[model samples]
Target: MSSTTPQASTTTDARRSFLSGFGKFTLSATAVALLAGRDRLALVGSAEAKTAGNDVTILNAALAAEQEAIAAYQVGATSGLLQKPVLDLAVQFQGHHKEHATALATTVKKLGGTPVAAKAKYTFPVEKLKTQADVLGFAAELERGAVSAYLGAIPILDDRELAKVAASILGDEAMHWAVLRQALGQPPVPSAFVS
Candidate 1:
């Protein structure tokens, strides 16, 4: 939504605070993206092993967020509020979230941690989603929160290479947000900073 939704705004605010202390842990990526460029992410150092437990916690949190995004897209796709083109875009965005979830789960397992499973339901504002624009607005709000979440986490990652991988994913999420805004006849990227 051009004017932020309550849920998305709250999540973004909370994540901003959580990500401020993100340096306490680190992520070590090994090919997190599959969009292009082979998505190669190598550990720059062995320091991450010492903080694997904390890393797992953070990764699981991000995984949970991505899963939520996937579920949100599913809700939008099946709401019968979107046209053919919009529905196709919603599906494609869901696929991206699935890829993100897969990569997060893979990394969590590599760190000897269990991935966080998706919940049976997420509290979406279904009553507010009455039109195609309403659905797009809901999705845009989620994407904006996602972009802010990833952006807030990227700078604080202890591993530079891991941050690089995260930046790539952040770029993808930013694109998703921008596209949703454009589809809603709003500015694609309203500001340089996600917040």
Candidate 2:
């Protein structure tokens, strides 16, 4: 993406940070690739390779990002720039982000870690959202970033179930990105690969 949206790089960097957060027990990229819509999910012995403590930290970071996505959607939903149909889509997408956050937070608690709290405010390019198309373009950029983030997590996930979850989330975010791009009169899928 262009510099008009800095969140793209930030989101990718944020997701990549989870790689190092593995700490003492890093996952092997060759161990898994649980993309959604595939029935090839098989049990892996690498589940034991990850420590729950480090998972909590990594999950917290993802939780924080999800919370921010929720907030970003809220901003767009109430910006008065989106039409009725677009507002409806924004609200629906926000709900998905909330669901994502819930899942991450629940997992964090299950792992005996405190989930990150949402900030009272978030930073967004509000001034650039002068038109409905601008808002949609901004949202598309964000969804693209989310797709990258979740896609980055898949191969490095130690647990097969977690890898599946990551891939499923990646698929959802990818669809959101595609829909947003389509709404903006752009190609839904610019390339075969997301990155």
Candidate 3:
């Protein structure tokens, strides 16, 4: 009777060990299956997955913004409201924007994406360019918008190189905004930190 009792106990212990291992294996397989399903769903839900991420998308967006800035500066330069000095500055700023656009286009092409072309005309407040103040104000606002866009791009870019490029462009755009603000009789250094 004692031997029979030990045999029963050993059999119960072996059964428990096998069942415990099987339970763990089942849980692991289930977790893996769930994770795979989630990944598939994410892949099916967006074009981002099709592109293998947003690097090219981000670059193309930046390129488009640069094209818009170039067009805006062209309009401002031709408006005749700016004095000689201001017009020269606008031309210089426009050149800088062109350079940025070229760089962005090159990068986009290198990344296997198409660079966005400039539109024949952009929809700006052409009717409001009656005075120098209006022109300067519009230019300043456009610079501010460019600065904001580049600032926003810096952190969201996944590649460190692309982020650095964005930061460089951000600094230039911020400088342009500050100069425009100063020209508009506003303080050049409005705040210690640019938002």
In lDDT terms, how accurate is model 1? 0.71
For lDDT, the strongest prediction is 1
lDDT of 2 by residue, 39-138 (tens): 2222223443245555567668778888888767766766678898889898788777776777777666655568999876567877677899998998
lDDT of 3 by residue, 43-75 (tens): 354554444247668877888888778667666
Compared with the true structure, all predictions reach lDDT values of 0.71, 0.69, 0.68
What is the full ranking by lDDT, best candidate first?
Answer: 1, 2, 3
Ten residues in a row with the worst lDDT in model 2? Answer: 30-39
* TM-score, every prediction: 0.75, 0.73, 0.72
TM-score of 3: 0.72
Q: lDDT (0-100) at residue 183 of candidate 3?
A: 90
| Candidate with the larger lDDT of 1 and 2 | 1
Q: Which candidate is the best by TM-score?
A: 1
- State the TM-score for model 2: 0.73
Mind giving the per-residue lDDT tens digits that candidate 1 earns over 16-127? 5334423332323346332222222233345555466566777787899998887677677666778989888987787777777777787777666789987755677777
Q: RMSD for each model, in Å, please?
A: 10.5, 11.2, 29.2
